[model samples]
Target chain A: MTTRRGTEERIPLLLGVLASLAIALVAIPLVGLLVRVPWSNLGSLLTSDVVLDALRLSLISSIAAAALSTVLGVPLAWLLARRRFRGRRVVRAAVTLPMVLPPVVGGAALLFALGRRGVVGEPLDAITGIVLPFSLAGVIVANTFVAMPFLVLTVEGALTNSDRGVEAAAASLGASPLRVFWKVTLPAIAPSLRAGMVLAWARALGEFGATVTFAGNLQGRTQTLPLAVFVSLENDRNAALAMSLVMVAVSFAVLLGLRDRWWNNR
Target chain B: MCTAQRIVRRTGAVGVVLGVLSALVGCGTDSDSDTLIVFAASSLVDAFAEIGAAFEEQNAGADVMITTGGSSALRAQIIDGAPAAVFASANASTMDAVVEAGDTAAQPEVFARNRLEVVAPAGNAGGVSGLSDLARSDLFVGLCAAGVPCGDLSRDVLGEAGVTPSVDTDEPDARALLSKIVDGELDVGLVYATDAASAVDDVVAFATGVDMTTPYLIAPLDGAADPELAAAFVDFVTGPVGRAVLSDKGFAAP
Candidate 1:
């Protein structure tokens, strides 16, 4: 057999060098973080009640937000992907608006809409005697507000691009529309759903501005790891560095672990 | 074309691009620029603006540039090599952080004093008059979170009053707490007297029973690019003109 030598592609040196620069832009900060890890203080800082509390809050809130996003986002994605109706374009824009809205602004909006004296919130408060602000529920709501957009947009894109032939065939075979969606379309786009969920969970975990703005920064109640990092960053650099390392390590591991399970399968 | 020659040419082009990008980044901030940089706390926003403008008019060829934020944040920046000539903090301890970092040329001098006051929305709908009123669990109260000077002072005042009020939120700064009060989301908020005085239209301030005064401290950072100008700026802040501005803004005499 003859080797196909002439068919080998030649990569340009300029592109290769410039691509390395882009990689360095991402890598240098991570390298700097690793270098300034405060290794001696890391164990104590991690074991501290403050760190544990924030870690617990961040995990619970993020997981809750991701689950909430899926429960609400899937139907919205389906509507955008499949339906044609009045103000459909407007609906799509509104659905994805949170993606572009500043998280702080989102927090303020949430405050007004659901705050104690707010339009819905006032009535809700009077009837149920439940207040949302400065609580774990507030953090979860803020996270869901910001993170749900990511899942919605991702799942919508996947749904739009996915083959509709399978669903149509199932319907022709006398399967109900709900059955078709549950068995045929959903299974076909399972990879995208998983990807959207992971993206949303990560976004929720990193949420700081919205959470701090809406939920307030009360330790073990509303303060997540990001808030803890910001508070510690000013007074205690070592503690801040340790907390940041934990966040970075957790996020890195999550993305890495998810890549093989969801990404490569597609 | 020969592969080696092509490679050399590509490397030369990439080097030129990288150099241009870095040069662009470096060009924005020039240390030699004749502007005098002052880092002040957020509470000093109104007073410092006037002081900065007055200082500029008094000194020929000296433009005062002020950067204001949470005092603790500004101090952290100074430690991280922010080229601030003067540091005026909302509290003494925040300024001490810079002094202890070997960034200050002299001990921080108290230039003004601020007191914490409970601010209620217009009409005092919740009838929150004093610290005792804040203890009412039904009243939504906002206070600055601890570690911030205003927050620290608030905690002290609340502790002194012996009322562990059910706080709805702990804001990062006094301004945020004040805004919450103005928005009517919070029935009452503990903020600096200066903050309430500044927003008189939106909120009403009531003097706290606790006798606590938060001292505003100023220091000239060491190794200032223009040490003479930094020293002069510090003098202007503590001198008659600065005191007048601070007083007008509801700050007490140091």
Candidate 2:
């Protein structure tokens, strides 16, 4: 009994040590960010027109991308999670191709698919004379392409883990499939959906490679916060730090707001 | 009871001490002698790789590490205190920023010059003959962003022509613009002559009326761990062998 009790006591101590080490690894870089951030230029950096424009574009495009991803991704998630069709496993893997592929490659792929001379783009250009590159819309498209995977993966996980019996009961009660999804499955997955939205938004906000590749970094049009950070780092170190601080603060707020349900329960 | 509690506390303290000691050792092992870091512009990738290898061969018991990126990004990394012995930029402007920050050991030197060329997809379907053809409404044009050296030069040429191009895209680098042209996405793009040479099979050049050439610059950073070696590499790049390599790659001699 004493030996068993000693082993049990050692488990908590082991967990404590592991937890502290993990915390230190994550905290060190965050602490470095805070320590090295230029506090002196904080005021002027925040008010810079270019920085403001980039911030505004980042927020607008990220939100737009997340919204588009949610609209399109939710249905895809449903198909993958609720329905078991032919090649379902293959389709699920293909949906996550963007997450694993390099963002720059994804952007290049976007250009091949949607550029002026792209397969569909060529006909679109011939008919409408509209070009997608180096425009605000292009930024949205690139962000959506890279960020949709996050939403789909998260919501799919939530759907898979959910109690499917309730969904079936609702369907058997003369409720249509759409009604069952809206009234039962969606509410059950509300917390997961919120978490997925935040993840998608953050991913879209920090998107640099794909945005620069497909959209082209034209200031005030396609230059989001991350692109601005890259440009600022080239010329002004202080401004870069300040811009990074803003990104950190925004991300912190978002994660904190979602932590209670998304993290604690999980 | 008190004796047993004391023994447990002692073991816990020893574990904590060992953990702290290991962490300190891990943090302190980042020594300069491990390697010499060089930050260089993307344009100098081939030449610097060769020079870096030669430097390592000549200096026994020393390793050379090179980081290649956009000139602007490299300058930013140096300014942000990246541990680099040498810095080479695609243009004087980026090198000047490092000098202004008091990070340079000496004045930067122009090693080579690169001129702008109008590059189009192989077998130019648009029949683009010169710079003036870029202004045609029917042709799609891609140019580098104004922040990049090639883009700035391209703007100079366009200004001289008194032509306003219907630019469809402005990429961050000459390489990206060149890729768009090579993919047949654009009818023409402004790129470095060397880049056009590298992509000969995929792209061909048209004449530009204006001479908007850019010079490559190199400097050793202040307080570099291996200042002498860094300076020697810069000297070699500005010497005969480097000139030959640059010229062979279609770059103009400085």
Candidate 3:
């Protein structure tokens, strides 16, 4: 009896030590970023014209992609979560395809679909005389393609876990389907949507392969912060480390701000 | 609640064991031996791979690992303390960067030269005949970004022609630009002669002058694990065997 009690007491301590070690492993890279950061040159690196251009482009494209994903993905998530239909399982699998596919492969697929001579892209080009490849719009499209899955998966989980009784009650009270969704379903899932949006934005911000592949890496145009960090590392190590530190700080701040509301709401 | 607590406890214990194993694996290091790691530019992939195999055959039990990427990227990796025995860049500038950091064992030697060619889609979609036709308004041109060697050479040729073709895309590497041309996304692109040769089925090259020639340079990095083996590999690359491989790949001997 005493041995059993002692073993039980020791299990929690063992778990605590394991958790600490795991946290330390995860923290090591972040600590390395902090330690290697050039503090004195940080000012100049941040103020550099190329860094500013890349940061601005990253912000603009990430936000645009996140907004577009939310707009298109929320409805799709709703359909996947609430509606029971044929091929629903297949649709669910397809929606999560981008999440599993390699980013470079996803970029290649995007090129095949929307490139200048692509089936639809050719007609669009002929009609509008506009090309999507190697443009800011291409960055947004690539980000949205890769990021929409996060929004869909998160919101679908929220929808599945929610109390559908409230939705049904609203429906019986003569509220239209759209009205019920906007008033009841949306409010209940707002926390999940916010969390998903943050995740999507973070993913889009760190995007390198797709953006570089689809949009091309032109400074002040297609180059995002990650691309800039990569390109800067080619010639300037200090500038690369500085840019990495900045990105780490921004992502940490965003995640921290959303933590209390979206993460702890459940 | 008790049953749930028991299940959670079991999961926590398993997670702890797995985490400890992973940490141990992460800390494990490889045993030292007579191995030479060569990081070369992607353009030299075929030639270096052949040379690496030959070096291994020549020296029994001496291993050679080759990591290939864009010249700038490979150089950056070396700067970041990658355990590279030898560095071969597609251009002199990248080699110079490594030498400026005092990382080179000796001065880099130019072993081979490659020139840019205008590659068009399989059927010649844009009627691209030569370098001059690239500037036609109807042609959608894909060029490497200015930072890469191929792009720098393309810029030189284009400047000499006094024509600024409306570049539809600027890929980060010659391979990506070549892929775009092969995919029929771009009517024409500037790529290395070897790359054009590799994609002969999908792309046809247009002749260009000597102005677009890009020199390939190789330098042994200082503090290599196996400096003797590194020097031997370098010697092989600048010798007849390497020249034969490069020539077969359409690269001219410097």
Best by lDDT: 1
For model 1, the local distance difference test gives 0.83
Query: What DockQ values do the models have?
Result: 0.46, 0.34, 0.37
Off by over 4 Å in 3: A1-13, A127-130, B1-34, B132-138, B210-212
Question: Where's the lowest-lDDT run of ten residues in candidate 1 chain A?
Answer: A1-10
What's the candidate order when arranged by decreasing lDDT?
1, 3, 2
The true-versus-predicted C-alpha distance at residue A22 of model 2, in Å, is 3.2
Tens digits of lDDT, candidate 2, A151-243: 999999999888989988988889999999999999999989998888999999999888888887766878898988876665566777898
* Recovered native contacts, candidate 2: 0.53
How far is B118's C-alpha from truth in model 1 (Å)? Answer: 1.6
- As for candidate 3, its clashing pairs are none
lDDT of 3 at A257: 85
Error of 2 at A241 (Å): 3.3
TM-score of 2: 0.82
| Candidate 3 local lDDT, A115-195, one digit each (tens) | 887877888889998788878999999999999999999999899889999999999999999999999999998899999
User: Where does candidate 1 stray beyond 4 Å?
Assistant: A1-11, A260-266, B1-33
- TM-score of predicted chain B, candidate 2: 0.82
